[model samples]
Target chain A: MKGPAISIQDLHVSYYGNEAVKGVSLSVETGNLVGIIGPNGAGKSTFLKAMLNLIPKDKGDVKVMGRTIKEVRKRIAYVPQRNDIDWDFPITVLDAVLIGTYPHLKLFRRPKKKDKEWAMQCLQRVGMQDFSKRQIGELSGGQQQRVFLARALAQQADLFFLDEPFVGVDVSSEETIVKILKELCRQGKTVIVVHHDLSKANDYFNQLILLNKELIGFGTVEEVFKPEVIKKAYKGQFAFMNEIGVSL
Target chain B: MAFIEAVMQYGFLQKALLTSVMVGIICGVIGCFIILRGMALMGDAISHAVLPGVAISYMLGINFFFGAVFSGVLTAIAIGFVSQNSRIKHDTSIGIMFTAAFASGIIIITMLKSSTDLYHILFGNVLAVRSSDMWITLGISLIVIAAVYLFYKELLVTSFDETMAAAYGLPVRFIHYFLMTLLTMVTVASLQTVGIVLVVAMLITPAAAAYLLTERLWVMIFLAAGIGVVSSIVGLYFSFTYNLASGATIVMAATSIFVLVFLFSPKHGLVWKTLRVKKKRASLV
Candidate 1:
């Protein structure tokens, strides 16, 4: 609560003796729409998971809201990639969102009417109120992503981590998601996204953390979105674009 | 009607019938989760692993139920440990542990030359179920059903998305082990009636049919139970009248129902989907 909203120091993660996320350090302030852009297999998703303590970190110091991750885990929400979910699972959209409140409920107690109402409200926020009763498999890819966002919203978390939220999503759903994310930032919540598209990165995030297995730059869009930094992070593969003034 | 009357005249027949119904309901309930999680092979492994436990229990002159449950749980843990600690995949782990345990059981039986019939344990003799076995089946069924009812949501979430469950701070590991323990208990309770060879069918076929019929978890569960009970009753009647192997007859009954649902269920059945496709093509023409 005093320092940055999220602080990572000397974070290192490995899988099968191969380093996935090299030693990295960064700090993010509260209310920042931070985009973590990197090449494929550059540990963008691994870094987010490491920060949340979802995966084992070989060496790292991660603190959220000036507190250790364990102390504030309940205050954090994560929307994993769509590929990690079972699309054919037999659950309604409302039931899926209501799972977010499971941390607050007592054991052996079912979700009450008020909890259902709150879940409906979260669905409404994501423009999925009409589809709450439908099974998850019946929805299109974009609607499914929106439903996942609604689940995150139902958590009422102050810190949100989304991995590839726009992949395979329709344009309208992507816009709706961006609008809701900006809204969350306006409400003083920190939203960190693992983004891929470089063209819309400037318009989407106020702060950008360019990474390629290591921290390349962490600053505002104007400060960090430079030609030299983009070229270095993408290993000189970024083509020069006159519109964004950077070649990512 | 006369055949039913003649079958019901014996006390052993009455006990066996009750045991069949109880086994049917319990297996049906647990089978829904098994098939949903794609753990049908795991169910097969645990059931097979119980053979050694039964042999050992007979050697020690203890309750075979305890031995069978212990062996089943030990197999589950071994599978989990092997898969987690090594590069061996889950299916491979299951295959290794179950075959080894089953082999050990056979060896022990042969070495001891125990008079306890191994054939009965392997293929089951449902008509031979004693009153005590019926009581044990009843108690285990009650416990399994209650556990499923109490932790339905937690189990549902964990089975659906384990990561989300862990993120929500639910004791996912504990839930997993507890579910494994319940699976073992059910497997052990069912051993006397269905035997090792056919137990997996009892745990899978009815639930699979129900899965084809319904889209909701609770509905699938209830429908599975209904299918299991009906199959058990009909199979028992046929076994009584025709003097066939009761366990095999019951499994065949469940399989018949599954085939019917697979072909004819209005929502997800193969026939309907094919018909719908043909109709659309015809309309285009």
Candidate 2:
């Protein structure tokens, strides 16, 4: 971990007159795989949205790679937590993967051969190359998550914000995503994941940003994920966290 | 010999037949997108909303098609803008826009000093379909079909998961607005042949029947077109024999087909699934 890749200062997020994320601030280093662990309704998702400026913040500043988020939009990729899409829609998986290249492609210019090849490569990375021509509805939950990851891969950005990528996914898919994240960090790309499982924290991420609406702590897994901070962040919750201490 | 003589007798009947087949093809291709995207109600709303556009165009004494296109797309854009800005959902926005458009059409019709040409807007007197309207519908439908074929993949992704598509750098916002505009155009063009009330049946029923039959997109589109042509031809024959409105009869026929398919489709049909379950239980016993 070196200089900060993402800087957050006094961030606050509210929804429909209720504050979900109170004042929070943290800086994340470049190429660090960060895990956010908190109890349910602890504003984890809200904080993630605020980081990307996807949701309106009451008062805050988020700078990615020393520039404002809007200025560095192309360098950042976001995969939403809950996507309420119409599943039976008429499109092949290849079409869905191709969309990941939209931000880089010129407006009004159709996708060229190189763009198609990139889409295929991303799907291949996710091991979904065989399902490229399959209908989206035919895919299982884990397969769908892989496609989502493939979309992010297509972006080829420096920073990726993923909201709960492992939820409802199969073991193989989870391992595949973890491997991909590791590869991403190796390539000097930062990956921020909103993870629910505390047991897998140490195994998945080197840096831990513990929170419960407020920033409890942010450091390496060894430094920040102590018993004291874990209790404060997820007190009276996570029976599994008590049974197994950060090793699943 | 008698049937051949009847076919050769009147040019109007031949024109009407050709018009129905062309419109059938257009509806079949477009309606597949509508069904898959769950915009079946959007198509319905646009058909009803085109009424005022037609009535106002008729009063202006200009190309009615142009008037319909302008008004229909305007209503669509308005709906899109309002829904995006407001907290209201897409369905609610559609309902509000559809009612307002319909009311405006009624007011305009009542204000016109001339006698109510209600049939032109409501039932679409196929007997009165001019060569001019035919040319317009044909040209616009061809363009729309061609566009759909070209951007087949983009339309699918946006329809399935808009946010993911947007994040991936797809112009989801543009596609959303473009889809509504195209739908409005299709509705306006078909208004003369099918009327505001029956155009929905033309847009929805064929695709719905196709949905019951297949999960494949290409197959659904083909099936929808086949059903549309059958309904149009059979209904036209019935209308000619019984002195009924051709458009109304065609929609009724399509509705009947929908009911039949919905009841008896092998996989997802109501009757087959029920009976199959019962048979499985019986075998277990």
Predicted structure with the largest DockQ when compared to the true one: 1
TM-score of model 1 relative to the true fold? 0.95
Off by over 4 Å in 1: A236-248
Candidate RMSDs in Å, in order, are: 2.4, 4.2
- Residue A116 of model 1, lDDT score: 95
How well does each candidate superpose onto the true structure, as a TM-score? 0.95, 0.83
Top TM-score prediction, candidate number? 1
Model 2, B4-79: lDDT tens digits are 3554797777767767777777787788888777788888888788778777887888776777777777787877
lDDT of 2 at A119: 91
| Cα error, candidate 1, residue B152 (Å) | 1.2
Clashing pairs in 1: A1-A65
Docking class of 2: acceptable
- Of the true interface contacts, each candidate retains a share of 0.39, 0.35
lDDT of 1 by residue, A8-76 (tens): 999999888889888899899999999999888889999988888878899989988988988887888
DockQ for the candidates, in order: 0.57, 0.34
TM-score of chain A for candidate 2? 0.93
Candidate 2 has an lDDT of: 0.80
